[model samples]
Target: MRLRHIAYALLMATALAGCNDTIDGAIDVSKVKNKVEQPLPGRIVAEMQKKNMPRNSPIMIRVFKEEGKMEIWKAKADNRFDKIADYDICAWSGKLGPKVKEGDRQAPEGFYNLTPAHLNPNSKYYLAINTGFPNRYDAVNGRSGSNLMIHGACSSSGCYSMTDAQILEIYAFARDAFRGGQSSVQLQAFPFRMTAENMARHRNSENFEFWKMLKAGYDNFEVTKRPPEVNVCEKKYVFNQQAQGSGQFSAAAACPPMSTPPALTAALASYEKEYQVAYAKAMDKLDGKLWYEPTEAERKAIVAEKRKGRDLAYAPTGTSLAAGKLVEPEEFEKLMAARLAKQTAKPGQILTASTQASAAKQGRVVLPGTAPGNRSTMSVQTAMAAPAPGAAAPTASQTARPQPDMAQATTTGSVPVPAPNPLAYAAVQQPTETEGKKPFWKFW
Candidate 1:
């Protein structure tokens, strides 16, 4: 009788965790409309069997903000997790940073968990899974936000958003995991892949120390290929460890001395050693330059380029900063002027944006969720790439569902039209350097 009561309590807790949204009451998920629930797709079911994952196994999720991907890892027969699928994030608000407070419009970054209560089948934007932001770590660190979610709609305010179809599939994964008796699913969110090279690039970011802490847990999972047990103490995250004494872990209080198994420590140390070497190489290559968003003049140039139909939809790499800080300011201006001169010298360039603007205007971007072959028709072709006057009227493209002003894009924290697309960017062939023109180098 006692065991039964305990189990019921645990189940109730699991059912009620992290649901501070508009959910009224739980509905029977079965016998629902296809919009409210869907069975695992047959293709996914077959992949699970091939990978030795159970139909309703526990799962883990990891999100990369810059990459705009969400990966699902399911438990295999051995109880170890294997990545089952990666879903494209159609939209996520904010630049690469953690949400600090309400109304910041920044998506959160850190460890969170999803429980049965987190699922909202009746969500306004198809189904949704609340992210349970301001987790213990966020709470102790003084972060504030509410109702952040992973949901359908391909839109975002301060949550990871996916296409309606993608979220339906993801919603199925969460539902099945709960049915499998998993109490909660771990959700790890990061600004980008915690690669040493990325770290070196962000070495000067205000959040470097916070990110380094996150990397510890990330490293733990990388070495073991399993989710690390996360606990917060002294307002910091401590992973895969236990207090030395009987002291309880407290998010706001100091962490008691903790201990880890020697084997785990050894593995993590080995991983870190390799990581350190990579970090050194990256730092050396970057040569102490830190990345910043485009300056005022650079953004104006981008605006001008778009007016001339330069395919700012996926602008060439270094075009982000108008080649800022890289070349001396005067030299960079000269570069920009020369490039503009070559562009306006053509008739076709002025005619493209109006034609392109009449496209379906369905918020076209080729991310993981796009049903392949939907790439923007604008691959690199040299047309007359002129610079418009700084005060030129809205481009022909602007007459359609306008791409947000680049400055508003930066201020609002949404990934802009011309932002970096790392997943497929390696295939973007770079332009060759001519005596008067520079090649595209740095990416946004």
Candidate 2:
């Protein structure tokens, strides 16, 4: 029995040795030998100096897929981080969502950290850093994918691809940080800038709940300008806290008594207070209308209204005035008279206050800065017939529907037209249709 135990111990020792060798062998130092020897770029060094940041300070990377931008942030002496540089991603695959399975061609989105073990110096793509997919949160969700990378080559297949030149500079940044004793570098991947406006715009998206959770970490960083310490518990990301007793965490286990530094708690509270004020202001600016699909009834009403306007604008001759044909002959005579009067009027003859007020009461869409003679076809025929020197201005009901100003139209003799008061058109409101049915779609 003693001999058998000795043999078992020897086997376990051999297996451990083999595992270590395999891990070490996976790294190809030859591929990065030249880069490791080369000095950091002069521009980057100069930027660090200007920011008063020391060389070899810790770094964080942020990738915004929608903007196709990658930003590098480095720690300063004050314990805060500042953006050092931004690079455009040469290429990427898939759409704006997290990768779920292998062969899906989707890029993963979440907070991931990388160590030297994640680097691939011998990549076919000039240089590559494996994004450690199937992270704690992903694993708890049963997601599966592998070998996802941020690499050089200007080509992507489930990766963020950068130009060779850009990668060399990026690779150098990482190497120096690692050499300076940074055990790991955090990488925050986001779909876009997480602003209140953007969040409101995507409020009805399917992934809104997930995005809200991501925003917590995003907000933390935004307030402190430092990476939030992230951990996974109950399959959800918890920021800047740790289990009280064990001082350890498990992605699938219930979270232990967690606490945040008092200073961070205070800062986050202040940030949330300010954010709430701004968020309310932003929401108030919106008209509370979903910009997505309209109801069937609303669609039909819009179509009918457009058709009715078209018929009124081009009615046939002899139609009753009540049936939407503004006495055609009288309108024609008015247009001709306006044209003749305009040709003879003095350049300095501005419209009188009462005339302008009458036009406003008429709901005529006036192009404020346009020359008096420059008017739309309908305006010339009805609202702008250059009233004879002392003639009365027309009332609101007397004019036909307002038409677009000719001065602002895209034509040969176009000129700048002043913007109208936004509130002026607010008087016209479309009636809402009540379908009396529960919505079939669920945003959550």
Candidate 3:
């Protein structure tokens, strides 16, 4: 009965108001071409060194949906990962929840791993890294999806997409790690950062239990600064646990007796103790609070507007919007204008008439009732800059649309997406690792 209900939900998912994805066929991954990709830009390498991160060290990622941020953490001299940068997510489909079935249109929230074979060099949306969803837990729980990717398109449909400039840097990071003999990279996707306040704010969410299940992994990484060894047993995520006495794990079968590292166990106890106190106080404040839950009319109006918007084109026309969200057009243009400047400052690119014209308004998103940006686009000379070190972050917008950092003007339209096949492009030419130094992730 439970399985039947889920299948029916997937079928009605598009029609239903809460679901964002529509059921689609298996996504074909194009074969990687034998192209010699560019190396990591010199400035990025310098930035890594400034942060005490090796230029080609192993990296881990964490994605927060509500925050619309993707943080890259790299191994340092101590072998513990430290955050290197937080790149804004251009677009991610669906709301704050775990993807339950195929076509739910939800960006998955859980642990994923990517290997060299998963890199799609010749992608329709620039470079892409396949997020290997439906790991043991998803399969055991009967969820279904494919080709859910973290890619270089400023648009999404059941994927976490980013600006082309962003993906270029990101893709190089993974490529360098692989070159340094790192086998795989870990990505932890969450509905939002697992701060107690964030969890409490969404206490009424239908996916709270699942988010809590994911929180264990979130907490593990927080305390240890390492990706937990993710395992699944009895249809649940089991993180950083070693089975007692050679006990193995099977997704659908019962979990064997297991134990966590003593340090993690101790650290987690302290972390949870603090989190619980904060959560309880937050929940108390929520009691009897009068929150702004939009009416049915408002929700429909917003959904209709998104359907008409430019970036939301990849989503199904009938896809529903989540409650209590509205797009802020004015500020979006400013930030996008800034991003365009930075991406375009790439060396040796000739701009033609069409490109120059497109460059004038590259990646502009038009939402209903929102006025176009009156300010002129930043010139190549002006936009080629990053936010100053230790500067305050951008103000949080009501919603984030794909105001792309236009790395190239050609990224505007759809191109031929290649069929998934073996990529040649140097499958694994191991770069010499630092003598006697294993990647920090390998320690755990």
Candidate 4:
């Protein structure tokens, strides 16, 4: 009887395993049906054919907020991902930062993933893929938020929005990957491009430490062109193993002994070595000083030089009454009176007629007007020969005055205009925390 019972137990165990396999097969079949029905499957297949990649290959996504770009990377037969496309993010809320809480209306920045359940074909925004926010790392740190997504409709509250056409293609990529047997797709979102220059520029930001931690993961894929195995330990993200043992990982507990593949280890080491060399050179070029900061004297000199260039470019150049040389007070008053009289001269009267008449009355040599063209020439000669109302004799230098600089009249300080914030859109309705009633079909 005991032997019979053991046989029954073994048979039951085998049956259960078969049932599990059957269930998984059904799920995959359903996914394949959904994917095939959409136009995306054909396009994906064509892309794979063009690249000499097999169908249902793995894929990944990377988002750069400051650049407003999302890149799709597809795994080739060699197991390394190749960039397939870049889509413009149509709209995203908030500035360059991570989403921390509900109602903050901030798009998240960090590593996240999507599963089959996260796909929403019936979404109001046309389609969406939920970003698994508040993952193990977020939970350990007590962060909270939900339903963050990359969706369509070109509008956003706290989501990355792409046009309907773009989302159609993006959604198809993820769907085909899932249908191809991928369990989950990884998505890495960043505030900006992770580079040595960007790191140095934002070194003093409050989020610098967190960003540095993220760069480890960024560099992993950057070097290997493969998605990094992600794990959270002690409330921090740890990527690509550093020690050897079972591959088990825990979110809140101390990380277990882990080891990286020898080839990956060597590659990462070489990448870091090159990065350090470049970083050092960049720092040395800056003399270890912040690029944005300048001494007061240096700033003033810069402004002065800019002002001088502007004046030279824009200042008007011409002969004018104000260009006359400095003279005795009585002589200056007489010149001003002559200019005023010439300006107010009656119609049909020559511009210098009043000045010439006054000069002739003072017993000055007044030349006769020749032809119309020569009239101006005669007037100029007559004025040059005339003396001030009550001044002494003239000197040779007094007759030839240097043109005055019109720098003050032309120089204008440029007012720096602040750029408009891209996130300043009409406020979107905040998502409610209450879970809606589940479909009756789910009860089964």
lDDT of 3 by residue, 298-343 (tens): 3345446554655643332122224443223345344434444554
- State the lDDT of candidate 4 residue by residue for 1-444, as single tens digits: 999999998987685444322322221222233432354434345667788665668889999876578998988887678887787776666545678778876788877766666687778877888877766667677676777789876666678887666777788788777767665678899877777655544442335557767777888788878777677765577776533444345566666666556676677667767766655555445332221211112223433433454423221111111122323334433553454455356767664555554543332112233124322322442332332111134344123211111000110123121232222222322222244532211221
Which TM-score value belongs to model 2?
0.57
* lDDT preference between candidates 2 and 4, better one: 2
lDDT of 3: 0.59
Q: Indicate the residue-level lDDT of 387 in model 4.
A: 29
The global Cα lDDT (0 to 1) of model 2 is 0.57
| Cα lDDT of model 1 by residue, 1-444, tens digit | 999999998876665443211134332233345754466655677799999999888899999876568899998987778999997676666556789888877888988866676777778977898887777767666778888899876557788877666777788888887777776688999887898787665544446556767777777788877777777776677777755656666776777777666677677667767876776677567553434433224433543543355333222111222323333323433443343445343655542333232221211111111233332212100010111111124244211111100000010112111223222223323232334322111110
Q: Give TM-scores for every candidate, taking all chains together and pairing residue i with residue i.
A: 0.62, 0.57, 0.62, 0.55
Q: Positional deviation of 266 in candidate 4, in angstroms?
A: 1.3
CA lDDT scores, all candidates in order: 0.59, 0.57, 0.59, 0.56
Choose 2 or 3, whichever is better by lDDT.
3
lDDT (C-alpha) at residue 221 in model 2:
87
Candidates arranged by TM-score, highest first: 3, 1, 2, 4
lDDT string, candidate 2, 103-152, tens digits: 87677888887665667666888788877676767777778777889887
In model 2, which regions exceed 4 Å deviation?
A: 1-33, 286-444
Instruction: Return the clash pairs for model 3, or none.
Output: 21-104, 21-105, 22-103, 29-419, 29-420, 30-418, 30-419, 341-383
Point out the worst 10-residue segment of candidate 3 by lDDT.
402-411
Ranking by lDDT: 1, 3, 2, 4
Q: How many steric overlaps are in each model, in order?
A: 5, 0, 8, 3
